[model samples]
Target: MAMERANLLNMAKLSIKGLIESALSFGRTLDSDYPPLQQFFVVMEHCLKHGLKVKKSFLGFNKSLWGPLELVEKLCPEAAEISASVRDLPGLKTPLGRARAWLRLALMQKRLADYLRLLITRKDLLSDFYENSALMLEEEGAVIVGLLVGLNVIDANLCVKGEDLDSQLTQGDVSVERDTYKQSRQGLDEMYNEVRRQLKEECQLRQDVENELVVQVSMKQEMELAMKLLEKDIHEKQDTLIGLRQQLDEVKAINVEMYQKMQVQTHTHRHIIQQLEMDLKIEREWRQTLQNDLHRERDSVAQLSTEALQINGLKKEFHRLQDENVQLKTICEDQEKALEELGSKLSESKLKIEDIKEANKALQGGQVWLKDKEATHCKLCEKEFSISRRKHHCRNCGEIFCNSCSDNELPLPASPKPVRVCDTCHALLLQRCSSNPT
Candidate 1:
């Protein structure tokens, strides 16, 4: 029971170590900078520490030493008897007590295998610590395997010796340690070498994996930088395009403004041309009227000079008659009276001629006024004729009007003098007269 308990404790210890080593190995396989891998390592470390404590507590338990005794008895009661007999044998107590230790060793082996499997299943156990531990585990496994093999050989020999003892009641005739020990030693050396070689190969593989990961990380960084540069370039190009578009818009606006100014100038030029043509026509008409007035004035001046000459001749004849009267004044009294009456009559005739000349001058002034009125009427007619329709021309006042305002019969107010009624005024007067009975 003690042997079995020791074996169980050793198995638990190995199992815990193997689990920790496997977890560490998984951690190394992940990206070294991965935060989750770090967290996993922390959990593994905690679990390992807990396992160690459990192992220690288990080893300290009194029941743990004898826990497997019942199981052994159930499997083989003869084994218990053999154990007792070995304990009583001279110089064989220690060997027999230790013989059952194989059970613990086997358990340790299974635990180690389980621990390795745990490491293999995990995704983050590729650290240097894990690799080194794995190598150590491999070496340890080889040693454990050798021990197990020797134990198996020893158990077989014990089985044969027990059979002999049962048959012949003899206990000193069976011997198998020499050949078993030789075979175990040879197997241990070969396994050790193989374990060392495997360790070296695993180290090389781990290094290669780490290098590949680093190269991949660097390539990813370079790709990110390139993308950033491309994005920046695209943004710059967009800005340039926007600037150019704005410039194009400005140019278009300038062109539109220029086109509008040109149109306005064209309109102004046309208006000025029409205005100038109208002014030229008005100036020509004014010049022709002025020429006609000058000719009339010249004719009137010549007529006045001729009339003055004829009046001078008449005055000379009157003076000569008066001198003849004075010569005959002493000749006869009746003749003197006649001469005086003649002289008085001559003075009266001269005064009448002067009145006639004044009357003619007033008549000429009235004729000029009438001519001016006629000219104004003609100008009004021309103005009406220039329009599309013939407008009304007031015969009494010479005022122009449209066709609708040409009613001439209606009289204006008496206080205002002559009534020059348009169509509206004529209608208003008729309306008022109809309303008033008188």
Candidate 2:
């Protein structure tokens, strides 16, 4: 899956490169048409004043069209965004002004292409819709160029009619001149109306562009603020990760020690069990000997008194063995209870460790720590906190201080806003700033 995504991104980058080149070529073609535009203006002026022979190809018509035929506005939502930026530029009423605007737009276009390339070349960054939107801008450029050419052609045709009217007047032809003059007058009126309509459209377009630019500028500022916030969050998380890793190592060491202790406990329990087994075996042997002695006495009744005394001694020994057995069982039960208590302590220790971990996590996640009110002196300056000089807390180090010792407000990574820091923290921050000046 990863390999396929990489391949697709590479292909998209190549396409973006091709599109950039095409846009550059389009701009160059427009630049080359400047001379032709000047020549067309001159020819039109001559045709308007005096009749002259003219060729259709004299205007050097641009025929290098290579963009989409569809309306870009309909295809690409981003086209409006690009057009909005054009309003930020100064007006282009003169030749020099237009050229400057064109150059600046060209630079902007190149920059935009670089930005787009970076975005699309990243995996899953460019969606299908955005891709289509990019291609739409290319068609929009083509349409603008085509419109310029069409406007020049219309101007030339209008001039041609003027020249014909002039010719009829020079030949002293009354009726023909009157009709041609009226027709020219009517054409001029229509041309004037068209120009006025185009002017109104241009003004409206400019207004829309201005509104869009304001919106874009505001959005850009908001994005920059958001980016700063994210960067600070990342730094804080990295610090938390380091702290957690240290705690993990300590927990691992504790676990190892606990394992060793449990092993020792198991050995002790095994030893206790072995001692009980030996005591039980010895008691069984002694009981068997007593039974044999009793059988021997039954076989010879003449030795009854002697056997009776021996039997009493055996009974007393039996009673002593029973007491010893009971004591041994009691000792085992006591040891088992001690072992259960030890296990409970281990479990309690584990729970305490987990609670400490949770507390540490909370502190890292911006839970504020305050100094105890019992403290009477500043931690850094050792100054007494009095009614005149109140106690203050450093947001960074969570230390109590006199108000003068903790007066600096600085941007803290854990907080969204700047916070009061102690003299020690402020000095450290300054040193860090000097070490890594941006």
Q: For model 1, give the 10-residue run with minimal summed lDDT.
A: 151-160
Instruction: Report the error of model 2 at residue 434, Å.
Output: 99
- Candidates in order have lDDT scores of 0.45, 0.50
Local error of candidate 2 at residue 174 (angstroms): 6.0
Model 1 spans > 4 angstroms off? 1-67, 71-175, 223-438
How do all models score by TM-score? 0.20, 0.17
Counting clashing residue pairs in each candidate, in order, gives 12, 0
Best by TM-score: 1
| Candidate 2 runs further than 4 Å off | 1-180, 230-438
| Minimal lDDT window, size 10, model 2 | 62-71
Residue-pair clashes, model 2: 0
Please give the lDDT score at residue 101 for candidate 1: 36
Q: Write the per-residue lDDT of candidate 2 for residues 202-302, one digit (tens) a residue.
A: 89999999999999899989989998998999999999999999999999999999989989998998998899889889978877866765566455455
